[model samples]
Target: MKLSPRMQFLVRNGLKGFLWLTVLLAAYFLFREVVITHKPDAWVERFYARPMIIYLIYCFSEFFFGLIPPELFMIWAINKGDTWHYLFNLSLFAGISYLMGYINFLIGGFFYKNETFTNLKRRLLKDSASQVKKYGIFLIIVAALTPLPWSGVSLLVGSAGYPSKRFLKYALFRLLRFAVYGYIVYQTHQI
Candidate 1:
């Protein structure tokens, strides 16, 4: 039997999802070069002197569709400053990254609105709306902490028009997640 339109769309989206995952993995391998070379000091000298631009770029990267290696450039920034400055820089990076999560959320929401996706949600997310309303904040925090790809969640929130106040609160928690993970990485790597 021939696949229906919905089935075809699902197949296409599944392929797209696989492609996206491959791209993310390949990007990480590409970044391994920079990590291996270890140009931390040079970057420190460059960005530490001009943090504003760096921060803006960081935010822009996270806001757009950029894969974060968590430390491609952040390590340099951290070591370039005083301890507090390091923390501040890390926090700034996290804040921008968390905001970018909203971009992801929007994308997911858009996909959710698609004819195929809408049908999928109607069938799968039978209680998603009510559950979202009740425990959205908790879910956001969990997604943020775990490497569950939060941008999609953010996109869903954006598309659903989830309350802005709650979104922001959830976003702050997401930002804090960066700090938490970064500190762990920094300590473990001693970088």
Candidate 2:
């Protein structure tokens, strides 16, 4: 017997769902084992507990954005405590990162309005324009996922006069990327 296209699509998605569930379960077991066997690092907790240090790290890291992978901070947060703290750190990092990206977008807009910077912007972002056109918002999500310089992409898209609403809408995926990557890193990172 043959299945309809819709049925085939559903079956494929169902299988994918099951596979993900299995992988997640295995990861949970591994994480639990690690937590049980390893003692939490006192210095890591001390460093994480310092609000001034965390603020400095957040500012500097956000300034460096793509240059400095945010995973280091994410790992630090995961080491801070349990799942709730990990999730809080994910949201914190994502919010700060998104704010920086928005600031970069505003800077891009400023460059767009200036003739000298506008020419330079065109030269630098010429290729990205085509890529953005081809892939639309998915390109932004891909950049975010790969831990690439999403601020750069944000700047380029903003300078190109991509609709502000659409840019904001698509950029929200940065939060999801942070959450997903934070979870994986939390589960796998040795305490």
lDDT of 1 at 8: 58
Error of 2 at 44 (Å): 3.2
Report the C-alpha lDDT of model 2 over 1-191, residue by residue, as the tens digit: 99865555445554654465466557656865687347556455667679568757776767565655676677677777788878887888899888887787777677668899768857776786565555546555655555556788777766666667777788887888787877778778756
Model 1 residue 151 CA deviation (Å) reads: 3.1
Candidate 2 residue-pair clash tally: 0
lDDT against the true structure, each candidate: 0.63, 0.69
TM-score of 1: 0.55
Error of 2 at 79 (Å): 1.4
Best by lDDT: 2
What would the per-residue lDDT of candidate 1 be over residues 68-157, giving only the tens digit for each residue?
544544565556666676677777677667767866776666665678877877788878766565656655665565544566567666
